[model samples]
Target: MAIFNTRDRTIECRIVYYGPGRGGKTTNLEYIHRAFRKQTIGEMVSINTTGDRTLFFDFLPMGLGKIRGCEVKVQLYTVPGQIRYGSTRKLVLKGVDGVVFVADSLEVRRKENMLSLKDLQQNLAEQNKNIFKIPLVYQYNKRDLAEEGVPIMPVEVMERDLNSKLKIPSLPASAVNGKGVGATLKECLKLTLHHLQEELKWAVQDGL
Candidate 1:
């Protein structure tokens, strides 16, 4: 759920980048921070935990305009994808308004991607959130590896494996090179803000 500050006329929401370990979740954030300097509000904070790190930063999108007369402020975060960090991932996912699942494109990581997605579903369920209903996007990352002659899953296969049932928006990306990073985030933000608007409408109707 997004926090609406009636006094400040601003709404703050969280969007988490989630996927298997070394799946380029952090890379997406890093690229965004570097590429979208005008929108980035603060330093990208990282919390290191053994083999993985959790990162977050604030972003204020310009052209999306206000929601219900409140300026929208977004906080982007990346959950440590290592399986051992399940608790941390759940904590970060709390009160999430949207999600970007960064699925690795490497052929060897096919099962890992599936497992991470299942982990996400379970974690969201624990918070009384429905993965199916939530604003979510799939990013098939590391497409550049294919140019290096590395084994990578075809976009169609990745969709069938991870997104066939969800049928959400999915984009092929090379996060390290900033390819599709903006587009991925842009789509997620659009969906999230639209979802928030509907929620706010319902809340107002219910006299909340």
Candidate 2:
């Protein structure tokens, strides 16, 4: 399981980005790293391969203020998007606080997006994770594909098919242009903080 150290009044939270290969997961990170390198705290590490890059990487965000006297830190990650790396994906997903699914908006990749989502669900389930219960977001990436860049499937269609039951935050994005990346990250951060606050409250009430 991915472990975090909550010591010396510091809190570390893990957030994972999951999607099919070539879904611009790496692009999202590169954009953020370039745009906010000054504001970010730690190094962003990447391991690339042929089919899918990023076996796993850390987008260590700068301290997002503080909570209950603990320094709050958000670390972002992307697993290898190749389906063959299923075992590695699960290994990285362990102890995740939030999830962002980067979906390809091209018509040809529609089914791949659906299948990737299902794979994510199954991987999380193996770790006793219920997506419905955890913080989740959907980023429909590569919105600049077509002349109009219209989604292959309508947003509503994607919602009904992949996100209706969850009702989580979802947005259209062109990761190449740095659009919607910050918005997606911010929403995930807010949700994760809310959940962590509840957990911390429970710990305090229990006198832990």
Top-scoring candidate (lDDT): 1
Tell me how many residue pairs clash in candidate 1: 0
lDDT against the true structure, each candidate = 0.84, 0.78
- What TM-score would every model get versus the actual structure? 0.89, 0.86
Candidate 2 lowest-lDDT run of ten? 199-208
lDDT of 2 by residue, 122-193 (tens): 988888989788888999898787657554766777777788788888999989999999999888877776
> Model 1: which residue pairs collide?
none
Residue runs of model 2 more than 4 Å from their true location after superposition: 1-7, 56-61, 67-69, 148-151, 202-208
RMSD of each: 3.9, 3.5
* lDDT per residue (tens digit) for residues 1-208 in model 1: 7887667767778899999989998889889888888777777777655455543322323323354456678888888888877887888899999999999999999999999999999999999999999999999999999999999999999999998899999999999999999999999988887788777642223211
The regions of model 1 sitting more than 4 angstroms off are 49-68, 202-208
Which predicted model would earn the best TM-score?
1
